[model samples]
Target: MTVYITNAKRTPVGVKDGIFSTIEAAHLAAPVIKTLADCSAVPPDEVILGNVTGPGGNIARLSALLAGLPQSVPGFTVDRQCSSGLEAIRLGAALVASGEAQHVIAGGCESSSTSLRPEKAVFSPQSIGDPEMGIAAEWLAEREEISRKDQDDYAVLSYRRFAESIAAARFTHEIVPVGGCSVDEAALKKRPIERMAPRAKSAFQPGGTVTALNASAFNDAACAVFMTSVEAPGMKVIASAASGADPNFPAASPVPAIEKLLMKTGLSVSDIDVWEINEAFAVKIIYTARKLGIPFEKINPDGGGLALGHPYGASGAMLVLRLFYGMQQRNERFGIAAVGSAGGIGVAMLFERV
Candidate 1:
């Protein structure tokens, strides 16, 4: 049994302090579900969502409610950090394959702007040190000998590729228009629709290569991909896998996930037509691609999380959606999408055009 992707779309990547910062996380997700429902003509009863930030009241249920899904419809929220979105799809695929569902929607969303801040350590507890994700990436860069220049170069390639893809209208078919005010309150007060665009200058490191031109800024966006047991004119999931590494070495986590995916699918790097590795940081992507023997040219042809902006939970599903679109445009057969998250978790999924 195969689970087919019927439709998919993602919100435009917004830079931090840019277009999305003003939007609420739940609001960000509503359009994605609405888009899926509108495009696939699927009812709300079949959808499930992945979310990481909101704790008490599951944002997935709230998002569905906000999307005007009937109260009788059931929705589940899942959290696997960065892998949440992809995992949601994995679960949906399994349910369909097992005959539990015929149609479903799975994806994720996040707003770093509203993420709850942890309380400060008052007593300097020895076992309670929780480092921010960026700091972890910095540590990984140092350990992997990945220079700032290399990171910036990779970022440049991502932006250039994304820009080229947009120019080619490669994403026009896949990206549905999100009609709503910008997340920014001020912007919303002025415009009916907020269009997001690339930044003019980089903000990561001054006089460095990781300019705004190639890196994704803090953004507020949502995306969803619809899956069904019914065959459609689209791609399907071949296999999916996730792995956990020692949080002490977060950057190296993706290798094991990719390895497991390859083993499960009995496929090699050469067998894949395209790769979408999340640019959690320059080193993580660079290291994983090099180890997997994936050609840079075949990797992230339409940009990646770094260039498109990482939306925490939504990124994994977004990667898979982009890979499906890429395969469709190229008339390719197979592709892989992977992402690394906090706590050294990683996920990888394989797809095939039917």
Candidate 2:
């Protein structure tokens, strides 16, 4: 009773202050879900969404309603930061595996444009003690002796790979077009039009290569994958697992999580034909690969969050969809998608062509 991804789609990764800034989170989500429904011909009885920001009343429910699913269909929202989308898929798979539901639409959506900056007024006492994500990455970078140069080089590689993929039209198949106000109205009306060009100057530390040209921008986007136990076509979820690590040292969490997944799947790193590791920061991926003894070439072949942008919640599920599509294109047999979150949470999933 394996749950398989019968269909999947994602909105284009919008650049920060780009065309997607005008779109709301739900507005981005509905289309992806609708596309999945239309393509798969599956009426999802439940929708589980991952979202971090909100005008919240069950963001999943609102997104489902916007997608035109039946009013009776229930929905739930999970917030595991970067791991939210993967958790949504994991939960949906569990429901299918447990016989609680046969059809489910599970994914995540995020509009970094809509996400609020942490203000002292709203920061909880707990948050006051928690390290900010960037600070956490910086700490890990120092601890791992990952020089700023290395981070910049990795970022550059990510963007170069992504730009190459775009030129090759590798992503054309997975991207769902969202007809919106033209780029002029969507981006230019609000800002100087010339600033909207594809490339930008370096914004990272002086002499650092993590420039605007290579890093992913904060943008609005949504992605969804239709899952079912009675799969008609597409890759199946072979196994999935989530693990937690020390919250303060969030960057290293993926290692243990992937270890558990490998053990659970009875497969070694070499057995995996593809690996998608969320690039919360360069150190996270580099460190995880070093710990696992996996080469950088073996991970994120087409780039990752560093290059494509991390919409926080939607990214995890989006990575899964990308891995599935990549494996299909390569005619590969196995793939793995892993994400590390802010609260020291990590999730990993193993997928195989059915």
All models, RMSD in angstroms:
5.4, 4.5
For model 1, state the Cα shift of residue 144 in Å.
Answer: 2.7
Clash count, predicted structure 1: 5
Question: How do all models score by TM-score?
Answer: 0.85, 0.88
**Model 2 segments more than 4 A misplaced:** 116-129, 181-216
Cα lDDT of model 1 by residue, 180-250, tens digit:
44232222222111122223343443433333433345555677888888888788888888898867556
Per-residue C-alpha lDDT of model 2 across residues 8-54, encoded as one tens digit per residue: 88988776556676677887888888788777665887999998764
